[model samples]
Structure formats: C-alpha cells, structure tokens
Target: MKTDILKFQNLNPEKETQISNLFKQLGGEKKQIPLKEVLEEGNHITLAYCEHNDQVVGIASMCAYHVISGKKGWIEDVVVDEQFRGQGIGRKLMEKLLEEGKKKKLTEILLFTEAHRIPAIKLYGDLGFKLKESRIYTLKMP
Candidate 1:
C-alpha cells in the first residue's frame, strides 16, 4: 500500500467520485469538503490517503489554524474502506496526516471519534494522543 498527502490539483473527476464513495462508507453522504477548496485554499489543509494499485482505500484530512497560543490542527474524516479495515490502512493514512501536520509546525493535533468507535480510539491512543477533558458540542446551521 502507498500513502501520500493529496494535492488539490491532483484531484480529478474520477478521484472525486472514488473519494466520495469512500466517505459514504464512513456514513458521510454529501458532506465532503469540495476538492477545489482543498486545493485552492491556504496550505493549512491536508488530505492524506492510502492507495493500492492506484485505488484509494483509506483517507484522513487535517485542517490547521494559528491562534494566540500557537498553530493547532484538527483531524477529520478518517475512514478505511470496510473491506480494507484491519490491515493498517487507516494507520498509514493517519501517519501521513500527522507528518503533514508536523511539517506545518502545528503545536497540537486533535480529533473527535464516536464513543462507540473503540478501535479508532485505541489507534489514536497508540499514536500518543491523550483524551482531552472537555465537552464537545456541535451546532447545525440550516
């Protein structure tokens, strides 16, 4: 398996379709950030994934920003194709994302996983992430 951070310019219609399908596997439908924005926006955004024989099998994204404290990064949409799970594909994608974050000189990286996603939680722990003692709240705007 090969993993790399994807450049927005490298995305094509086919790749967009493939990645959209991958997000569907993770239960996200029509929720992916536009590939154009991912490419045209500031360098703080990173999109990493694993591919085998040119087919993307896993993906993760990191978005970073600077504040008074320092540069902070957030990981999102981490998912491995259901058929490709348990083979370390997700780990590879995450490692690539982390590498990108470090390259950007982020002071911290954070992520949110469903409480029921025990395996993912363990993976984050093994990767040296500690649970933050704060409540997570979300508001949906229509």
Candidate 2:
C-alpha cells in the first residue's frame, strides 16, 4: 500500500473529508472535528496521516507544548482502518509523528491508549515508549 503523507500546505476539502472518515473509524461514531481545530498549526498541533488510493487509511496527531520542565509532544487519535491493519500503516503514522517531534525539538513524547488495545500497546513499546506508572484522571463539565 502506498502511504502518502500530507503536507500542511497541501490540505484541502477532499483530504479533510478523508481524514474525518478515518477519525470515525477510531471513535466508532460520527463526531467530525472542526476544520478550525484540524488546521491548528505552529507550536500547538501537528497532524500526520497516510493516504492510499484517495482515502486516508491511517492517521495520528500530536500536540506540542512547553511547560516549565521542557517542550513535549503528546500523541493522540492514532487509528488505522480495520481492513488496513497489519500493513505497517499505523507504524508509518507513528514514525511521522516522531519525525515531527524531532523537527519540533520536543523534549519528550507521550501517548495513552486503552489497556485492552494489546496490539497498540505492543507497537508503542516497539517504538521505544515505556509504560509510565501513572494514573489518568478525567472530569466532565456539565
């Protein structure tokens, strides 16, 4: 499968649609991200995706931030179409994210995946991510 990584300058309507579809595959529901959010560039966000035959088959995104400690990259929303899994597309997406991290000079990269996602956990491990002994807490506002 051919994996064409998208350049920010090349983003357009059609490609955005493909990306939204890929996110649906990840979230298991139709919750389209606004173009405004997807287009956040500079130090805030960078997105990477693999396109095959006019369709986005895999995608990953990162948020770059600078705390008092150091600059960091947080990986998020990684997903590959079920039919396209095991073809190294997910790996490619991750490599793209890491490559971006390097370009951004991030001090560290972090990601969180569900414990049940065994394959994803293994992939993250193979990519040199260690299991950090920490708890994730969340709160929703009404």
Candidate 3:
C-alpha cells in the first residue's frame, strides 16, 4: 500500500502540546518549553507534518548558530510517529531542514545519534554527513 504523504511547515505556536507529545513519544528528556520562549530565543525552528487526515505525525527542530569559522545549524530533535517509521517521512523532514539551512547559507550542519541507531546513521551518511572521529563531552549545570 502507498504511504500517506508528508509535508513540512513551521510549527504553530498553538500546537505546542502536540509537539510536546511527539517529543515525549520519542523518549526525549528535555522539558517542554513554551512556544513563546522558542520564538523569543530566535534560534530554533520546528517543522511539523499534516497527515492526510489533517493530523500531525512528525516533528523536527533545529537551531542555527554562528561560529568563528562560519554559520552552522544543528538538528535538535526529530521524531516520526511510530506507525509511520518505515515511510519516507523522516527523510523528507530532514531534507526540508537541510534545504532551509542551505538557503540561509549555513556552512555546516550537525547532529548526534546513539551508536545503535544504525538506520539513522545510514540516512545521515546518505545525505553526505561524515562520521567525525572525535569524542563529545557534556556537563550539566544546576
């Protein structure tokens, strides 16, 4: 059977609850921030889908930043409904984000995925991302 289509659009601030639900389904640990806070931060972009039944099925968020070398973008959270995983929805979402990054003249884009997520790593590699041979360290501040 043909899968329903996927479309990308800017997140509607009013749909924050739905966005939070999607993130929760994906096992994200971050607290849900208000949409107004996201807009005020001026760095994040959240993309969502409108399924055939007019329901939302996926969400992806990115943040753009300027570094000493040039502009860069980071993919923060990307989740497709569990029922929709095998469809091309995730790929389309990522393509849309990359296109936006390119339009803004970003020099690089980066994201991190757990080592066990081989499919995701393959997808990123197919889209021309390289595996950086370096360690990533993080510290949480209270």
Candidate 4:
C-alpha cells in the first residue's frame, strides 16, 4: 500500500472527499468539517493515505495543546477501512502523527482506546505509549 502524510493545506478536493467518506464509513455522525475550522484551531493535524488506485485506505488526526510542562498532542479518529486493516496502514498513520508532533516540538502525544479494542491498544503500546494508571472522568453536556 502506498501511503503519504499531507497537511490540511495540501489536501486536494478529491482527497478531502475521500476523508469525509471514510469518516462516515467509520460511523462518524458528521461528514466533514470546514478547512478553516482546522486551521483556526491551530493544533489539529489530519493524516491520510492513498493507495495506488487513488483510494484513501486510512485516516488519522491529532490535536496538539500547550501545557505548563510542555506541548502535548492527542490522537483522535484513527480509522482504517475494514478491507485494509492488518496491512500496517494504521501504524504508518501513527508514525506520521508522531513525526509531526516531534517536528512541532511536542513533549508528549496521548491516545485512548476502548478496552475491547485490544488491537488498537497493542498498536499504541508498540508505538511507545503506556497505559496510565489514573482514572478518567467525563462530563457530557445536554
């Protein structure tokens, strides 16, 4: 599989559409967000892969933030097409994110996967992430 990492600015219309379609196929309620939102947010990066036939087989995103200790990034929305899993595409996406974070001088990159997502957890650990012993709390708004 041919894979490449592209910044939002470098994404063409076809690639953008591919990304939107991929998100929906992965069960995202929404299709696509405006490019302006991505840029204005200033910390999020989207990575995509294109196969030889020009189909996007994978997509991943990360949001970076600054804290007192240092800059940190959070991985989000990682998805590989069901047909394309187990080909190392997901790992490539993560490698791209890590490289981007390093380029931006981030001190850490964090991610969370559900307990049932054992494959994802293993992938993260193989990429040098450790499971935090601390508890996580969430508050949903109406």
All models: lDDT? Answer: 0.86, 0.82, 0.69, 0.77
User: For model 2, where is the 10-residue window of minimal lDDT?
Assistant: 27-36
Task: Output the number of the lDDT-best candidate.
Answer: 1
- RMSD list, candidates in order: 1.5, 2.1, 4.0, 2.5
Over 81-133, each residue of candidate 2 has an lDDT whose tens digit, in order, gives 88899988889889988988998899999999988899999999999999999
TM-score for all models, in order of appearance: 0.93, 0.88, 0.82, 0.82
On TM-score, the stronger of 1 and 4 is 1
Arranged by TM-score, best first: 1, 2, 4, 3
Please provide, for model 1 over 1-86, each residue's C-alpha lDDT reduced to its tens digit, 9 standing for 90 to 100.
89988887688998887888898887743476777877676666788988888888998989899989999999988999998999
Candidate 1 vs 2: which has more lDDT: 1
Q: If the candidates were sorted by their lDDT against the true structure, best first, what order would they fall in?
A: 1, 2, 4, 3
| lDDT per residue (tens digit) for residues 7-117 in model 3 | 233446445566667777767467767655665535355443435355556767667888898998888677777877778777877887888888778999989888887
> How close to the true structure is residue 98 of candidate 1, measured as C-alpha lDDT?
83
lDDT of 4 by residue, 1-142 (tens): 6767666566678877777777776673545676546645354665545454788888888888889988999887788888888888889888888888988899988887778877788899999999888887877556
Q: Local error of candidate 3 at 125, Å?
A: 1.2
Where model 1 places Cα greater than 4 Å from the true spot, the runs are 28-30
Error of 2 at 35 (Å): 2.8
Which runs in model 4 stand beyond 4 Å of their true positions? 28-32, 39-43, 46-52
